[model samples]
Target: MSYAANFERMGRGFDLAHAIAEADRCLLCHDAPCSKGCPAETDPGAFIRKLRFKNITGAIRTIKTNNILGGACGVLCPTPRLCEKECSARFQSLARPQGADRPIQIGKIQRFLIEHSWEQGSEVFDKPEPRPAKIAVVGSGPAGLSCAAELARDGYQVTVFEARPEPGGVLRYGVVSYRFDLQFLRREMEDIQALGVNFQCNSAIQGKESAERLLKNGYGAVFLAPGLWAAATLKPTPEDIEGLFSSVVYLAALRDGRLAEMARRIQGRTVAVIGGGSVAMDCIESAVKLGARDVYLIYRRSYRQMPAEPDERIEAQEAGVHFLLLNQPVDYVTTDHNRLQGVKLVRTRLGEPDDSGRRRPEPIAGSTWVLEADVVIEAIGNRAPEESPEWYPHVKVNGQKLIQADPASGKTSAAGIFAGGDIVRGPALVVQAVQDGKVAARAIKAYLDQ
Candidate 1:
């Protein structure tokens, strides 16, 4: 089945009655734990209360006021592990006789409100007076959108430049449709645009010359929010294989609804996915949906050490993807014609804790295994664009090639040049990017005011 067919089967939008019923369960706590749990401080209690009161518009406004990407967040945020996990209602339930862990369905309620607003064509925000300074925001992802929206609300003219044809960066291209629908993302983009943030699509900034041009074009400040787009270096392997791909390319194809092309590459094949993060889950699930007969996710560490959410791992398993933990691929084996036939994997064991606190993987001696698979998809990780530093040399960088900036202010080494999102933090959750944008916006406003 095609990607669209898959979603059609999954269904879209929530039932309003069910949503309100869930929303009504909220105790409307004065000191909302859900809000405290949220990195962006989204008031779940307030929004739920509004939804319970049948004030859909008010609920959306409440959410979008804090998170410009609120709609997408409603769909993709791991609320069950974040906000919902800490909900007072759940705690109250735990204290009852027939103790049930029941958190008010905050994310679903937020989605309902957002969907309602979309149906009614309700605007996200009202236009404000224009400020004197023009702010240039690079990359139209969540961080750039958030920064642009916040600055526009503060009455600064903001122009968001995107390298892709669409305004949303990763949200539009990198995320799978099952996680976040493109229509909702487009609506959010529209709302941002309504706030007076202009989008310039298909514009890539790769070097200092472009930076100088943007600076010369009357932009008082520049915020580089270009997310990590570069795929990590793959071990030298035979690409003459029938199906060898990167998770980013695979997910992008799925998002663009090119399922036939994607399926042609993996259908009826035994697939091996490298890495164990959300993207790996995406790859495994995509393989399942695209008709891959056998899908194996080979990670270098134990299941407990996986970076992906537990729920995601469960979902991938439910979809019939096999997990081969504590194994790392050493090389891809190929036939004489260079067609991929299998992989040579080395057994791994947990070593001492690394600097990141996770136990590092140590290769086990003489534990080599050869796994047969027609396809191998690498989802290890992503890095910043190679030319980023060359393009903007003034931008500070950490060891990981992530843009170095003050988390509190989003200011880079260069004056009037700030940055945020994955580029700054190195492959973080979307909520973090939104928070970074909010911080950068405030900092830009303060800087321009002087």
Candidate 2:
């Protein structure tokens, strides 16, 4: 079975009439709490108002002014937890009938308007002139792209270096294509390119010396937004087994068409995914789509405490993925030939709050069990690449290896150097990284002006 053939988008966008209706539903609150809730500070009120008035180009400009990747983010960002959650209409609806208690569909409307513009072949935003100052951006993920777009708009000669062959880091290589279309991502990159942002793919900037070399070569500033690509440690890593895989590696393979090429290798096999985050949800769903006979999602925490978005879990469940919540993998059960067999698991109970402010999972004694697994995928989390600090020695890193940058500015300890995205904040929302890039662009401009 072709895994790519089975992919489907999670959210259905609004039609033109429905989009207009949704745009009209926005009270266009003066304060615009919805825009404030957005990390990228997208002016939903402005865009929706423009859409309401049938100014399609104006609406697109209003969005791309703040978020260059507005189209992709319209599908990727969890609007209910962010912008829609803060929508005034939500509170206004609470006073109405029960069934009518719904906020304006900000994400869908944005998706419709932006997509409509692209279909029309209309310019999303005006191009900016190139300035004398040259700046280098490491990574082509949301943060790097956002920063590059914003800086290029300011007339800086910006060049983005991507380690992979493709421009989008996680958005292109890690996220499932169904979640965010690769073509849309490339189009957005093209938009940034239109603004004079040059992208150099397969160019890995090694260490601090390499970055220093860029500075020596006369690049005014450097922004590090290379995201977390290293798979996080799974205690008693099942790597010794032949059928085990890391979630990051698995997704990358799937995104790059490698997994589909080898689809026969995993066809009809029982697959178990370990973790509670959105990545795990993607893994299980991918497994099912890849023709896994049985797909199991094993989570150490309860469903309520799962780090994944609520809708993501629902989508996975609807895709025929079985959930084994409150179960933690202890070890692997393999055959004498070193082939994969099963996973040894133990029951877990929620305890007091942990560092993440969620209830910690504690193992229950004497509750060991085994679950059959032809293949096991660990989707727990990702670690920052170790090459980070070594590449920019002047920057400080916390215990987790995340770069120490100002939350508001994305500035590092070293002048003319900044960092953001997963490298600074660990794995976070793409919108948040976009906001970081916007902030970093302003900071870099300020430094250059000084």
Which one wins on lDDT?
2
Q: TM-score for each prediction?
A: 0.95, 0.95
Name the runs in model 2 displaced over 4 angstroms: 1-3, 8-12, 235-240
On TM-score, the leading prediction is 2
Cα lDDT tens digits for candidate 2, 1-450: 246565534345788999998888888889888888888988898899889899988998889898988987898889999999989888876688887868888988888877887788787655566579999999999999999999998789999998999898888888887777677777777788888889899999986668657787889999999899889756555567788889887888878868655366577999999999989988888788778899999999999999899999999989888899999998888899989899999999999999989999999999999999889899989988767678877778898889999988998888889998989988898998999999999999999999
Q: Candidate 1, residues 1-450: lDDT per residue as tens digits?
A: 554577432246577889987887788888888888888767887888788888888888899899888878888788888799889888776567774658887877777788788788887677687778999999988899999999999789888888888888888898877667666777777888788888888888766657646788899999989898878745744344656777777788777768678778777889999999998998898788878889999999999889899999998889888899999889888888778888899999998999989999999999998999988888999998667777787667877778889989999898989999999888888888898999999999889889
lDDT score for residue 65 of model 1: 93
Over 4 Å off, model 1: 1-4, 7-10, 97-99, 236-242
Cα TM-score of candidate 2: 0.95
**Clashing pairs in model 2?**
207-391, 208-391
